[model samples]
Target: MATKTADADLKTASVLAFERKLDPSDALFSAGRWDERDDPARWAPVPVREKSVRGTISNRLKAKDQDPAKLDAQIDKPNLQTVDVAALPADADTLKVAFTLRVLQGAGSPSACNNAAYQAKLRQTVEGYVKAHGFIELARRYAHNLANGRWLWRNRTGAEEVEVRVQHLVQGAPATTWRFDALKLSLRHFDAPGEMTETLDEVAQLIARGLSGESHVLLGVSAFVRVGAGQEVFPSQELILDRDSTKKSKTLYTVADVAGMHSQKLGNALRTIDTWHPEAATLGPIAVEPYGSVTTLGKACRQPKEKQDFYNLLDGWLLKDRVPAPEQQHFVMATLIRGGVFGDGE
Candidate 1:
């Protein structure tokens, strides 16, 4: 058929890439009194300390190693190891996590695209989607993630109190500020309860404007976690490969000797909004990856065979001129916003 010939001629771009729009700086950790939260400047930086501990033989042993004599020998061998840790000083009851985020514009515009026609069609499709649905849903989910302090990660567990403050920065000062009782917001869903809806809407609108190229949006986020004096706080761990056996077994992240989390980790938490993938009903929302990959779960929800992965959906839309369903449109757009190298192979 003529249609088949045309399709065959219209190959995917050999070089297509997009830069990430939601940018976040490294999150630095500080410690202070719950009452002294008003003066974050006075807070002391939480420092990573090296600790030595004998490892416990608690891991499940292989069937062959389950022999009582072998197990006893393993337990007798001291697994001495040194690791890095971060904890609040005895005088401090709250951990202050601070970071900055910049929301850049241009969601679907590829930074590199060899195929001009495909690029044009892609832009047109993105513009159409923008006109029809806008970025409200995506923006709202991002705002929810901020309000809930999802970026706090392991430090959020069993906290006596958690407060998140988001400030819209303009000209180096706060133009608008929103304070959230982070514990009250559920992490499982994007919905904001009635009382927080108005505030959440304001934040979402600002994010939407940023994504739509209406304005530059910069946010300063500070989370105060009341984990009690001397309680341990969690910072991102460093992944050391091909390590020397004598080196520290665990290494935590730090910025200038201050405990910190990676910007990539924070960005991952912010974009955890892909609930439209096929397995979402049972698996819940996941970070918006092209393959709907949940690294922690070791599963890819958007399988190619299901024709739900980004390439399949995107090729169908741009090459075949088949507009996907509303939810799928959102997924595709969200993936564009997430941004990455997505070129087709020659």
Candidate 2:
């Protein structure tokens, strides 16, 4: 009836613990979403160490090396070699903290990436820019003056003649000048020979058609023989326009014959059309061989009437009413239209 009088007794169960080896790959601990899991919250937050005494010692050593003069001012009665890592915060990780110290010590001004090849390329590009822009400016000036009918002169001898002059201001007292009369364009006092030569040649061709009178006009470079000391003369290369020899006796052509020669020469130089093609006209009158023989298709075609017709056709093609082929039409239209548009824009 007393329920066997409860005795103070306690029973304890035995606990068993087992250790398992993890696979080499599975043993990895990631700080963030290092797997395919997109949820960043699933990853354990990385522990941020508050301070490191080892890092401070390393920083002091680095500072001493970097600025020895400033180190004495910063720490009086300093024992930089005896700085202890145990003095730092409890959560400090020396290895990671050392990395920060190294980073700070290594920081300085960025180094230049200079090399000979790169410098040469840069110089070439700058030179190209100057040359190109200079040519463009020259062309623009010429076109503007032409449009304004400024300084346009006619050939007194009747042979087509147009002259262009470009003067470069030289820097010197008692200034001396070098003159180049190529293609009837005079370049004076140009320091850069190559640029001056190229520019003068181009300008000369531009005005070649308008200049008529002589058998050959100056082109490229020419040497002017000075008659006396301190007297400079310019000798320029001449571009000649002569008729085929076979037609010399048949036609009564004069200095006026070179009217459309410039355009022909340009077309030939450009190689847009075959030389044999009648449409492939020269800027000047056709060249006549010494004995008045005309060369056509490697055959000597002799006739005054044919020569006259050839020149007439050329003139028509250049200035008069002649429909250009589709290719030529497009080329001509594009050039003329662009020129007109640019003129308008200016």
Candidate 3:
């Protein structure tokens, strides 16, 4: 991968970057409350507010006609969980991707919280965790999402491209600005390899060090996107709707929508280090991740007319009794996630 790193000579608008906080709507970190035992390394599927992954995942259960009460409890549990592997078929694609999760909230005194000491402690702890291993599983899913065109529709709503920026706050120097591609920071999978390339490891290590809270360091992420002709994109949060049926168009929707779009543009910001609660995962070379590693999910674009049927068909396959072929299951789930639930019903 191509890479570049500069000293304090760079000056850019990233000095006022905004953090793209994590959306806890996924199978991992969805529980409303945080459990101290929950590790950033391993996570389980839990019932989320979103309809796509809500409630019990019947397709992954091993026992036929499993107890409904037990299923509900599993969804409610706030600790690490072992999924019923027997319920699902084995997958052949075992690939792992690496990403560095570092803290961007330390160089400057954190003003987000009232307790200065607590904020500093929190930043150091997070920096330590990100440097130790970073997140692999989440990185893979994010790569999967990125590769699949998950945010394309909304992103395409505006003809304009977006620019993402990272602010590097030194103790007493001007902040530096950079992009993921420039830093060679991207979600890459290596199926045919003995170890990560020396260059990639070097970049990851450098990022980890920069993210370290050794000295007063402040980090923030921001973006710039302009629309072209024949299309329009507005901010998501700018529009106020009393109900879901309010008029809708090519508007951007919410800051989350913009952040999501920026992540897509940045290439490496998929579930980046600034997420709310710690999350990440890793898979070995022999066994593919059980949930949805191999699939046609990212292969084809969803036709406008078939949006409703997309979820309907998936629900029938995964949430119901019709177990599909192993590869088919992966593709279905992958496509389901890649084609985000937003704007589908409309």
Candidate 4:
């Protein structure tokens, strides 16, 4: 009996899937005084309420409806629609958002896979990459996002001061805590500033350990934003499909009437660490995605034509035995850590 050649065994798995390593719960919103942040028990949940507002005809009229008289008549009738809104109380000067993140182990293992040969080969490949480079870079970037309050989204914009508290949870209690002056960190880059580098390293090490199957990591994150009294805050918008115009025009996400941000939204912010793509020099870091897609921009930074997308790099590395550059390898591994189904149709 002759041994099978390596080339013959190299093939793309038809059913391969990876589980996401970084999992976060929905962020709940609350209101309190900036000074009262130490006493979170007294904080009140931010409630989502409905309000009716007259819509202005700010949208450009079509050529057919551009007539001055018709436009005046249309403007005269108030476009009344009900929308949901959340705001801080007049007495409250701060908004507090809290969430839990669970970091699981087994970064390269596939949750679902059919081909044993391909799975074994892929595992070996990932192991090789791990031996060459650890997950510190990726982990550090994630830590930066958490510390900088990137998950606060619009709420962080006009905040007079923003503070983030990250606690290492053990047995449902904080074992260690790290505080960050969020506005001091820039979101455009992941460079660790001098003052916060040491603390960030500790957080990154925990996350990397979790990813490398060394330990399970649980983080409790709380962000406090001082946006002034009675200011409105933005929550995740509910995507309502197939609804009539008479229904509420806008819907804010809520958990038991308390305004909340979606877990998916928080996850997206955490994984916004893809800065190795071709256009990254000009576009800055984007969310870690297979295609380097930025939905808001309606463009993919890593185009297949450039052979930089996840699929292309993965196939070349596994099937063609063409190893990517160091930076590109990091991107590929980050995508795997991000997790997705990547199976060849053929």
Ranking of all candidate structures by their lDDT, best first: 1, 4, 3, 2
When 1 and 3 are scored with TM-score, the better candidate is: 1
TM-score top scorer? 4
Question: Which residue pairs show collisions in model 1?
Answer: none
The sequence of per-residue lDDT tens digits that candidate 1 reaches over residues 172-204 is 999999999999998888878899999999999
Query: How many clashes would you count in candidate 3?
Result: 11
lDDT, residue 110, model 3: 31
Per-residue lDDT for 1-346 in model 3, tens only?
1211221221221112123322221101111112211243432212211112223443577684368887777777554322211000122111111112233323222324443333444344334434543433233444333332223334323323333334444664336644322112222332212232443333333343433333333443332323332222221122345545543322232232121222333332242221111112332111112122223334222232442233343434422434444333333332322223212121
lDDT of 4 by residue, 97-189 (tens): 999999888888899989888888789899999899988888999999999999999999989999999999999999999999999998899
**lDDT for each candidate structure:** 0.92, 0.24, 0.30, 0.91
Candidate 2 lDDT? 0.24
Runs with alpha carbons beyond 4 Å of true place in candidate 4:
1-4
Model 1 lDDT vs. the true structure?
0.92
lDDT of residue 133 for candidate 2:
35
Clashes of each: 0, 41, 11, 0
